[model samples]
Target: MSANLQSAANPSLSLKKRILPVWNQLGMLIILVLLCVVLALFAPYFTETNNILNILKQSSITAILAAGMTMVILTGGIDLSVGATLALAGVISVMLSNAGVPAGIAMLTGAAVGYTAGAVNGYFTAVAKLPSFVVTLGSMTYLRGIAFVISGGLPVVLQDKLFIFFGSGSLFGIPTPIYIMAVVYIAMFFVLKYTLFGRHVYAIGGNEEAARLTGIKVERTLIHVYSISGLMAGIAGVVMAGRVISGQPNAGISFELDAIAAVILGGTSFVGGVGRIQGTIIGVLIMAVLGNGLTLLDVDYYWQLIVKGLVIVIAVLLDKLRN
Candidate 1:
């Protein structure tokens, strides 16, 4: 029976070869489902419709932020200022609403503020040739400082109903934030899949010098990428203001960490240009489910932080192995 044993051992090895590709492609999705299943088993009401909706609603902000982060990461850059930009934008939007500006105009103005901030970041990185990390790190500090200065260190309460609807209201019984999340993902997916800009982003991430040599406007593209990231942060700020019904300077603290974690967990390369929008959303869902499940299990918030950090480390390790 030695011959039979040898054949059986070979089959197992063959099976591994067969399974690796699927695991690489659907690993995050599989992890998400397993997490859901385990939580359902151990956490009471974890599978309830209301709880599921709550998870989606809570994840919407992170999902929105991760969408922009995907582009930035694909280009082999990072934006540490998005969280600060969110806080500043939220504060501005709320202040404008309090000043009796139309909700639409105020929201747009807040987004514009984010765009300007991102453009400045891009300029420093592209034109000044400073590292993205350094530029955004500086931007993060100054932007938060400005938010506090303008608001005089006080929260601006949002009173506009229309503004609140974007955060709190539902359509066809689905949360409005969920709808916004869907739209952002859909648009991002289209842009990354079909547009020339998307190709350029990938090219840059793959090899910046080569892309430039091939006639890509590397400088212009970087500016646009960072600006998009800022705009998303700005939009997220408005949503947060609506949810909390106030603009707090302290809002979105450490949000950048979560976005980066989600992006990495979704299988995006930390180095850049090696991931998809689809994977990022799955990563976002995995994080949301993990957090929600932990809360339901009465896990301490501090422990949850530890767990999240560990998850990020593991994800990076897996990414390295895959690459």
Candidate 2:
């Protein structure tokens, strides 16, 4: 009788503990909802379905990049070159398509180029013992220069009708880009939760030396994590290019900052080894909401930048307090 009572009581305690961490994930969502409510009250147009879909569509690329960034950060590393890689990938894909290559082939080539860029970052950081921060930061500038040089600082356009569908098509009244984001997130969640690689990532972030001692193949894992980040940035570029029907050489400038902010706001620690995909999703939504709300309120663009910076600082402070 006592054992049965104890077992019943344990469920409630376990539930509470589980619920506590979830509150952080919920924080972004609550703020998003409140922002929407306030915006709708002030701007009647904010309640429109078109406006809502526009916000989701605009956020699609950032969400995709952030999803991969969440994984990279989990391994105690950062990829500052994502934005530059994104621009390069988009420019390359568009150039290929314009040069008589099939749209599909061009897209694949872009993804490959992006993956290669990631591999370079991984090699230097993992094998050469360089800090990821420094390696990616250097690559960020180099890659952006490459993008401009290759495209001659001009935009490239693809006239293929089918290729544009990936950006503009809708399924069951939802944008295709939004659907793509959903698929990516679902796959990422599984990879993070179920794979040996995922376990190794968390282990490495928790303690690289300890993980190495445990034979977790720390170098290889780090390489893979960064490669994934670059690949995802490439994917984002492709989607963005499709949406705009043109690849701008300077597209995705400063996009890495937004992605990193989203990851941190999702409760991922800069110190690493702690994060959740669910939280990332909420963080992405929060960013989308903030941007949308500001636009609806007619807030100055410069002020919006200030607000965003403040939000990131506050999020980091909160994360530090939690730790």
Candidate 3:
């Protein structure tokens, strides 16, 4: 009874000890809701069902990249090559499709290529002990070069209806990209929550030396983490190709910035070791809402870029506050 009274008398202490820890995740959710409400009030078509679905569809590619990014960051690593890898996969998939390979097979091949790229990143970052930033940066440059070389700095257009449908088709009033996003999110959630790999990821990010001491296959796990990142980018690439009905070498430029921004905005610390799929989803939606809302309001594209940069800055500030 005395303890309860003392606690009640010290609400500041309670808030400091309690409210701070969970605010990182909750702050984004609250901000997202507030943004939605604001958009609904001011932006035409903002709250409409069609526009809502459209936003989800538009966000799918970035969300997919962010999902893979969550895994890489959880392992105290980064992959700057995703956007380039995406472009490469997209061109390769389209090339294969043009060469008479089936659409499904071509898509699979694209994902495999992404996986292969990631494996190389993992090898350098983990086995060769190179910094992830340096390794992925090099990969990013070479991969973009490869894309340009293969595509001759041009876009490859495919005439296949099935290939186009992956990006443009819908099921039960939802876009195909939405379905792909959903599947990717679900699988990521499961992998992060119920698997040893998930645990190891957190452990490594939190403390690599401790993880290595515990006999975890740190190098092998880091490789998988990056490979997964690459594979996700590949999937994004294929979908992007479907959307344009072509593979463009310039596709996904600056996309790595968006993916990394969303992951961090979702409350994943840049310092590593703390994040969740749910937060990432919220972050994805927040980013989508910002772009969609601003466009509806006729904000200039250049200004939108500025706003995005400011939002990232704010998000990082909030992260600092929360931590």
User: TM per model?
Assistant: 0.94, 0.91, 0.96
Tens digit of per-residue lDDT, candidate 1, span 1-323? 87667658899866776787788789989999999899989997999999999999999999989999999999999999999999999999999999999999998988898889999998898878999999999999999999999999999999999999988888998989999999999999999999999999999999999999999999999999999999999999988888899999999899998999899888888888788999999999999999999999999999999999998888789878877
List ranges where model 2 is wrong by over 4 Å. 1-22
| Candidate 2 residue-wise lDDT, 1-323, digit = tens | 87667757899866766776776658667777887888889988988999989889999999999998998888888899999999999889888888888989988888888888999999999999999999999999999999999888888886776567777778789889999899999999999899998889889988999999999999899889889898999988888888999888798988888888898888887778888887887788888888888888899999999988887787778678656
Q: Top model by TM-score, which number?
A: 3
Q: How many residue pairs collide in each prediction?
A: 0, 0, 0
What TM-score does prediction 3 earn?
0.96
Tens digit per residue, CA lDDT, model 3, 230-287: 9999999999999888999999998988898899889887767888988988998999
lDDT of each: 0.92, 0.87, 0.91
* Cα lDDT for residue 69, candidate 3: 93
Weakest lDDT window of 10 consecutive positions for candidate 3? 16-25
